[model samples]
Target chain A: MELSARNSLAGTVKAVKLGEVMAEVIIQVGENEIVAVITRSSAERLKLSVGDRVFAVVKATEVMVAK
Target chain B: MELSARNSLAGTVKAVKLGEVMAEVIIQVGENEIVAVITRSSAERLKLSVGDRVFAVVKATEVMVAK
Candidate 1:
């Protein structure tokens, strides 16, 4: 399906850190890896594991950078 | 508007670092901040400036965590 987010990077699951309420999902995209903190229930629903192929989609109204 | 993404974070623009091709945008979410790297054109289109409120959306097939 089409996404409104402008940034969509194809990546592989590198690691998963589950917490009580939040979970940290790490995706390796090329030389860099992006991390996403999500709900623990969401983690369980997806049943994410290592070596999973996933796309990281980020939608932001404004993307700011440090000068 | 409603989004399919499970993670939606409310943040404020802290800084913007523009580069030749890509730009890194930093948003302060409470005490924690999230960073997003997007194309320069996308950054310019949004005209992101400091203190702008934004919502960070992340969509992934699976949200994993380490056991």
Candidate 2:
């Protein structure tokens, strides 16, 4: 079963910063970007690698795409 | 200004389905849900009302959250 916090971004893993037990991920969606804070375990599970094409799904009550 | 699938989801507005102009949003981050397809004038310029609680962003690569 998936948790409530489950949304996704399909793009290139432009960058990755592992910190403590959480990692800061930056996914490039076209010319825009999506930022996600994930746990080390999840990061490893995704086997996320720089330049890798992956989705960063996040379930948060705070999505605001604006102009 | 922002545009690029953007990427966001603060929750509520549990459901919305317009058409053509591309509007079919379902934002419920706490209970697993964040699907976006906007254009119908931003579902009324985010003035969207359906237990309104704005935030539904997406930039467009693909985000993946697993079990």
Candidate 3:
């Protein structure tokens, strides 16, 4: 799918921690570990699991730069 | 300041586009250009401009994974 978001880091799902409303997904991208917190419904919709190949997508507007 | 956000890419400000209530910031991180949309007030408070050194920060919850 076409996405306007700029950052899309390819990675493997390392873990998935589901909470009441949110789910924390751990992705291993090279030597870096990226943690993503998403809605439990979306997580369930994606049926996310460990060992899955995915792209961690981030929107440019949601990004903040600190000096 | 300490941040809980996982992604913090160091970059230099390339451009800053100011609007009525929002501002778009373009940061050059290596070969990639990261765009950030922030409130005009925050942008003014930060005194953001071109050629400034900054770190693009993103929280985990704002990140999504696409398979």
Better lDDT candidate (1, 3): 3
Which model scores highest in TM-score?
Answer: 3
Instruction: Return model 1's CA RMSD, one decimal.
Output: 10.1
Instruction: Provide DockQ values for all models, in the order shown.
Output: 0.09, 0.18, 0.59
Query: Model 1 over residues A1-67: C-alpha lDDT tens digits?
Result: 2333577778998998999978899999999999977777777777877898887767554456789
lDDT by residue for model 2 (A1-67), tens: 5466535546688777888897767777555567766777787888887788876665333344332
For model 3, residues B10-65, the per-residue Cα lDDT tens digits are 78999999999999999987656778998998889999999999988889989999
> How much lDDT does candidate 2 score?
0.62
Minimum summed lDDT over a 10-residue window in model 1 chain B is located at: B55-64
For all candidates in order, the CA lDDT equals 0.76, 0.62, 0.87
- Best-to-worst ranking by TM-score: 3, 1, 2
Instruction: Name the better of 2 and 3 by TM-score.
Output: 3
How would you order the candidates by lDDT, starting with the best? 3, 1, 2
Per-residue lDDT tens digits of candidate 1, residues B1-67? Answer: 2333677778998998999978888999989989977777777878887898887656554446789
- Where is model 2 more than 4 Å wrong at Cα? A1-7, A59-67, B1-46, B49-67
Best candidate (score: lDDT): 3
